[model samples]
Target chain A: MEELSKKELVLKQAKLAINFGVGVIAFASIWVFQFTIFPDFFKPEPTIVEFIPDSTEPESVSYFELDSADIENGIHVPTGLIVDDGCQDVMVTCGACHSLDLVTQNRATRDGWKEIIVWMQETQKLWDLGEKEVVILDYLAKNYAPENTGRRKNIENIEWYNL
Target chain B: MSKKDSRRTFLSKSAIATLAAIVGSKVVFAENFPKELEPVGLQPDEVKVKIPGKSDQLKILNSKPLSAETPPHLLDDEVTPAHLMFVRNNGIPPEEVDVQKWTLTIDGESVVKPMTFGIKELMDNFDHYSYNLTIECGGNGRAEFNPPAKGNQWGLGGVACTKWTGVRLKDVLNKVGIKDDAVYIGYYGADTHLSGDPDKVVISRGVPIKKALEDETLIAWAMNDQAIPVMNGYPLRLVCGGWPASTSGKWLTRISVRDKEHDGPKMEGQSYRVPKFPVPPGTKVPDDQMKIIESMPVKSIITYPKTGAIIPKGGSFEVRGHAWAGDLKVKKMEISIDFGVTWKTCELKDPINRLAWQRWKINVKLPEFGYYEIWARATDEKGVAQPMVLPGWNPKGYLNNASHRIGVRQG
Candidate 1:
């Protein structure tokens, strides 16, 4: 290497100093972003609130009593199901997988209810009901038996164009 | 400058470069790795349950009942893969099936001699056949009902066409020697009811003797050249082509030939029956007036350029889909881009198997950037076309053959 003049040596040193300063600043900025800014920016958002209505009123009685008026007048109960003696058990057990509307909408006899329960337990992996099975069956059969509201009259006397 | 100074500078530069490289690698790694995906709409227990080889894109309708539907867009292939086929289970699928021990029993009034055969013996004795069959749930497209049906809400993905390998039902019935008085053929499966009641049948339904004897009907053991998936019925299942899948029982174990109409479970009342005449949606017809649901109507579905897709404003797009008619062959498929105002006939491809869905494709030209509804309608050999709206629905919401509409935005 050739010996540098004093002025040229000063200019070279100045350029080296400027480059080193830039490198340091860049590295420091990245460190600041990683440690100070990133955590706040990437914080998790709050979870969405589910829409299930809570109407369970604290009661001192051994079990929640059904209001006969609500059942007779066809009034919608707080759970969106007909209130009855075994409603609490049904809600806890059946509501785990499906909405209560699936239970209330269809009318079935005691045997039919038993058939459905058997089907559910065998195939759907519903836990054994133990003593609650009897109470649930009786409740469903008593309140939700099939009614004789006859079906609409069949279309009659139309000559078929094709079978 | 001295050689020593130059060497020292070089050493410092290399050290800095190595440090920078390590920092760069860490930053890149953080940005590129994918985050864990959580299952949507699943309970805690359901999150752990996994269907082996199943696509993650399938929408789970119910985890306990194991009801799922394939997204219509994902069904692009002519023959649906076993893993992608929609799963609709009435009961829990048996955890492990012993194929060796499984036996199929054929008995009832029609048989010359009641017979029982192990799966191996059955496969060995019967002549094997394979066909591409489309099995659609009767409740398919039930979600589209206005009032919403009581059962699982399924989109168009409730149906799938798969290559089913099995023995023909007619051949088996012939081997067993059906009597002249037999009027119906009832089916039973090994899957138990929910209550585990030994006496109760989860869902036992059958077909008229004439329909059961159809050449296309089969007792399938394999789907898509593989052992049938557990959810689809392993060991054996009845492949009742062109009818409600319920008639084709899964995990089939017994076939009962009857002298009169079989009154099996799910056969009575309005379980799978619909009104004889067109009735307004939500109307309940008397049991005597109801007729058992049979052959599905002609229908078409657009599989490509899924609904709500956005395409380039001036690009040419190809519209592709599949069409099928129950029993009858598909004669023509028409596509409409302007909400059924004007229609263009699509080129229909030859079906791989009889009664299988026919694929259709057409080149579409987008004049300008706007929203468009692509409608596909199929007409059967009998000249029956799909209705513009859902044909009159009964309480059960069956046989919805409205023209499939896929909305797309051109931008």
Candidate 2:
């Protein structure tokens, strides 16, 4: 008719430009396979941070910059308890339940650190350190005493079998 | 409305209402808080979840003085599954406990008539008896102590094998009589003392009144048939079967008896003693040259393709493990993959209880892989066996047993 309706409108504009170029290369290969293989489905989800009391924001005492070679080898003294002078009353009272590396790995004697702070104030519920129990038993009998570092080495000269 | 597009749409709607009020207040503070009000030396990081009948590959190490361990390939079963057992606490594990007002006294001077009972008159007047013992923890492999060991750096999951039950602590010391000049028995326990010190006695420990009148010493209150898990040692506890489970104490109530060696509070100096001879790893002996550490020796672990484990290069695998020994029995085991210059044996099994543990197996056959290891060892039926290293370090590194290994890999 008019050159076949202008060649069927140029073959319907070349099949809508090859189905919009294969739907833009299948939507750019599914966004490059979701940003290169599932990228944890586009990350960014962890947020939860509630606990906002203290009269709604008046508690800021964060601090942490201590690593001057871990406070000069007593290792990051936040409570490895060796900032000296009664390390803040043994870090607000015996690091509040276990680990100042269990009082810097045992060694005692100010009457054995006042008999282990009176056996942890008469059986481990440790309250009453009234009068700061002689400044935490004079900083745990002057920096954790007890040294006679001996007894341990024994496996010598192999060859024994019998089983 | 172009005032910079309404100020960039009110700054992205106040930054999405401050990120939905900070993630809706952290999901209502983790669904109404209470993990003991948080702030307590915050040491997190050791995860491995799954605790339904345990074996989520343990290794907890200290959840407030309560330690944990299991991964010698989830301790290949044969009992030991009160949630993969292994908790070891020295204090702080008693919160409620009223088990019919618990009791258990038994008095000192080796009794004569002292008694006390309760807990339903000590389980309706005695005679129960269960078995399958194997307690361990005489510093079970104190982290292969080379220059290590001071305490609890255990490995090979300290040790387990359960089925306890209860009754015969020599039929409650022959119905409260004993007294012939006792010669140790002690035992105590209620727990507390992580510094809440009810007069400090976190580890009483005793035994040796002829191994506390052994008839396979018990007194436990069940442990595989349940009831015994208030962090292990609920109402009563003592088992003492193949010794060294700190002479099986745990929350018991009392039981003195003494005459000589029952020093109590982890009995005197060098707690649980050791080094009656080979002293060199650090050397300081002289508490009558130390000794105390009761049983536990010819060990063996491997579990099953665990150390590094990769496999599939030439094939044929198998391996497995378990072993034990302390009141004798294990007999042989062996294995070694190329390290001890070649060895094999294995296939043991037997032991379902006569003081537990056994297991073994073997197969192997890689022949072209790369890394290897494997090891194992064991022995005992009194021919001892085990030590390839780590045999003597003591200052509380107690009995190690060595051998074990594992490694694997392949390509």
Candidate 3:
């Protein structure tokens, strides 16, 4: 039977510990050197783009309230009347939902508006007009009618831009 | 003990220690970096999950058709092609119809009589006119809101400026004298409501009386120089200048004047409201908890040399942008070359229309060419210019009028 002396055993253990310690030290040294010499290589550079942070807060900009001063200043003067030929009563009743501006701004004939009214009744479930439909149609026909004024000047000059 | 063994052991231990140090240090460094500074690359393939059927059968605004899947950022052009314009239908688009079969009926509580008429009779009966107006989505520029808001994130190009051919609104009002008790006028489009609770009611919206009399407002049948694109209300639509885009209905069908304000899905509950005060971004405002939306704030965007364009340094470069306001004219546009340190007022071209966007062009020497960040800010007639810093945040994204900052290479 081979027997190891205590001193020999101690030496063997010491040698193993030293080898492990040295190997670790060497690996760490390489990492330190890399970080110092090439720090940027580890991290990607951020995009150099500037973006304006949008505010989610809704700002109370302004609304179209009746401005006597604006009208008096001649900025927005009252235009002449718009009456449909056969729908005075209907115009009055429909005006209840919105302003005459809503009605007069449109350039449709009586049939177009009629379809809209039908759609509203059938789809939107608007209250029945009872007898006011005829009067409204007459007024729309009389006042706010379609006019073909050639081509719109502003749109005509919108030159196309290349992408 | 072998000398070689001791040396090797010592080296290994030291290496391990160094590795341990590096790993520990890396964790600390990573935690300190800000999220914004982190490289979050472009998500080219990102998909938006939306509420179902909300976007079905959406029409393109221009002649150029766009796949419904197109991203909003891809629409950065001088004029958003008709197909590229955002489609925001209140209801399903109606199939084309014969004008012969069409009729417009005006009804509801009013002093005048209720009426309905055919297209021929209406056309033969009334006067008509046209005007230029700008229509924008109510949620346009939502992406620009700080703190982030909840809604469709529209880019800057959601708005389109076009000449609307129609008759005067005041003319019709004059025909039907209001009974003074009328409070609101509601409009309905030909579109069908999305799949939801049937009891929820059909889509409708309304505007007030005073605005109806404004001469600039019109009932338009034509957009640009041609018939109104089908996506934009083919038969007839309202054109209210300086109003929120949602107020101008599309696929318009019916108009009813009401004695009192009508309460409905889109009238009192949707579209035309703002946060009473600043809230956190991305918050959904509760219904009956916001202020009514009104005029748009002064805003501008640079169109030329687009952001991130490479330009020759020290050469003469032209910077141009479009500026507009709710009710005022653009008196001045300023350019900052030194990143807000110095500013030079740019030259503005003559305004084509009194109430439309004005083009401003600035020829700058761009002296000492280098990679410079260029920005443009517009000031309105009211002396209100774009704020350098956003005021705050809200649940519903509203006005995002921050000046534009474009990156350009000067060299």
Candidate 4:
């Protein structure tokens, strides 16, 4: 058997101790660093607030309801765009939750428009249009009629190949 | 050192060397593993959901299945793999609920009564069975519009065929007694807080009475013979065969029978519409430029060749695809290898049901090495087939059914 020199023994001892120390420190630090830093890294950032309709107000307009001026323009205007036509108090109330563009863009008949406003008031909490219902009817009947030209353009003309 | 001590020293020395070797190899092994598997920065679910967005509206949901494609061979047998099935949701998916607590409400212009029944009541009162049906988004192939309209811009994977077991919608309506004036039956989803429209905070859509009375229209509780996953509208949902995604509301909770049509963005003005006139390509149509969207056109895609795969010379392979039509049956499917110069007819297998997609197959001999474009077109019995040219483009994009094409290379 070869006998080890004292210098060699000392060198071997120092090497083993240092390697063991490094391994222990590395393992411990890996766990500690991970435990300490991980939560923040994985945390979810703040999300943009999604729109929520008012649950409390029963008189608020349904988002789809179109006011009278929109009917006159033949465009379903958003609630915000309804001009302050002094004809009726209902336009002011209908303009609160939506823009006049919503109403103007739609092409519903007078009855259909009335039902929509009623649905908004009943289900969506839109406020009453007060006594302006007649004006809204006249506005919708005169201008917001559906265009006959656009109805026939659906799937009839497309070409289809064999199976 | 003693012999045992010497052995320990040797083992420890070798172990240290091995450790160093492992650490070095690990860096290389990390490269070998997919970047997804490594703990770079995100969790598994987060990474799974973050499919690079193709459109502005295609959100990365935290829970829905990541993809909608399955290997042809894996789909060889009955039952589409759950992961491969297409997902159609109007809004964020709802969490799972106890089936017993959930209820289906049937109300509106119906004469007999306003009634709400639990799932058990529905199952017991009506015949329960499974039928195969295909549900596709209204915007499934919308990305193909010639003018490049704005929508999800989904690829060919936005559809799925599945076996849904439940009661017929007509049976439930009959029990409630449909009024004479009922022209439409609107379906409302329980999934709440839809993002875009205020009136649409609760999205409700409907179908004509003719379709509502479809014997195949089912109030499905289970999908693929298992409880429908939460992402796919758990508890119960209405599946309207041959109709677009908007017609079949997910997380369905209410049924309202109406004398007149249900009017909403999803109904009167959106989801189903076409251009008022055939316009030039690449046009962004104004709102006034559109007409209402209706029946789906015929469309087919080559599911094989794996998109850019290189097949060996003299390789003989089978090409397969799926085709479906709205309100009519697919009569024939044709395959064109020479860019429509000459066409070969493919064999279309019998559909599992009238509503499901029919599988098509053709054998092709891969010619000399070059890039080949494989084209498939389907035609319905009504002679309506996929159009090569799309003339309609609208502000709210609708109805994009162009012939499906894929490119492959032969080495």
Query: Quick one: best TM-score, which candidate?
Result: 1
Full ranking by lDDT: 1, 2, 4, 3
DockQ of all candidate complexes: 0.01, 0.06, 0.01, 0.01
Q: How well is each residue in B20-76 modelled by candidate 3, as lDDT tens digits?
A: 232222111122122212111111111221322224323222111111222323333
In DockQ, how does model 4 score against the reference complex? 0.01
TM-score of every prediction relative to native: 0.68, 0.31, 0.56, 0.59
Alpha-carbon interface RMSD for all candidates, in angstroms:
19.6, 15.1, 25.4, 22.4
Predicted candidate 4 versus true structure: per-residue lDDT over A41-159, tens digit per residue: 66688432322436873322222233455444532232222333322223333332332334443455566567667766655445455544665665655555544433122222222
True contacts kept of each: 0.01, 0.14, 0.00, 0.00
Q: Give per-residue CA lDDT, model 4, range B2-60, as digits (tens).
A: 32343234334332223223223212111222111112111213323432212223332
Per-residue accuracy of model 1 over B1-411 as CA lDDT, tens digit each: 132343234334332223223223211112111111111111224334466557878877655556788988788899999889988777545555788888788889888888887888878998999999888888887666654345676768888899998888888889888899999989988765433333457688888989898777988999999999888889799988778878888998899998988788778777788888878755657889898888877887888866766767577788898898877789999999887889999999868888688999999986777767788889999899988776777767677787887777677
lDDT of 3 at A161: 23
lDDT of each: 0.71, 0.68, 0.54, 0.59
